[model samples]
Target: MTIVVAYADTPPGHAAVTAAVAESRGGEAVVIVPAVRDERVPDVAELEGRWPELAGRVEVERGDLGDPSDTVIQVSQRLDARLVVLGLRARTPVGKLVFGSTAQRILLDATCPVLAVKPSVAGP
Candidate 1:
């Protein structure tokens, strides 16, 4: 079963991915990082620096942006994914008022079930 986990340069994404894999049917997961324009994607080497500890848990597959929500939805439908996993970042007061969160977008756009996780820690 395909499990698509939304990844960012944050602990939430990593923790969310871990949670998703644990709850999945012990299948390989594809980690997707939506890289917009030419610079938004996080350096993979840095991402993997710590993730190697959990590397055995999944098969990572990154996705560069073509619209994060749209891309995730398409990937889900095409892969027939069992679940689309993503972390719901704590929205800032201004952010909540201005733009919606990616987690919300994914939840609404994905055809399959979406698992949203929020990590215990966060970054500024």
Candidate 2:
């Protein structure tokens, strides 16, 4: 099974992608970009440009538009992924309370083990 990665093109997303690549060790690394209803899908080229290392190493799947957590879960199940990797970003209590937490939902709902990583303070 492949390793599923949830990417948003953010710092935390970058961290997750990097971690997944390292963990893949030449295995499959499937990158899933979540798309909410009516929201435009992220540009794959831009993403690849931002992270050159992913060009040949990662397989990106910009799934149908929907809630991020749902998209991640669905992709993982469809792929029968062994693991789901996600990036965690620091958020204020109020922000989390108001915005709700995609990470929280993914963690609680995913069938396989989920790996959550934060950007290293030392920098990339």
Native-referenced Cα lDDT, model 2: 0.76
Question: Candidate 1: lDDT of 59?
Answer: 49
The number of clashing residue pairs in model 2 is 1
Clashing pairs in 1: none
Taking the tens digit of each residue's C-alpha lDDT, what string does model 1 give over 1-124? Answer: 7777766646677676667657666436555545221224445455445555335444445455457666767777777888888876677889977975667778888888988887876468
**Residue-wise lDDT of candidate 2 within 63-119, one digit each (tens)?**
663687888888888889888999999999999999999899889999999999999
Best by lDDT: 2
Model 1 residue runs over 4 Å out of place are 27-65, 122-124
Error of 2 at 95 (Å): 1.5
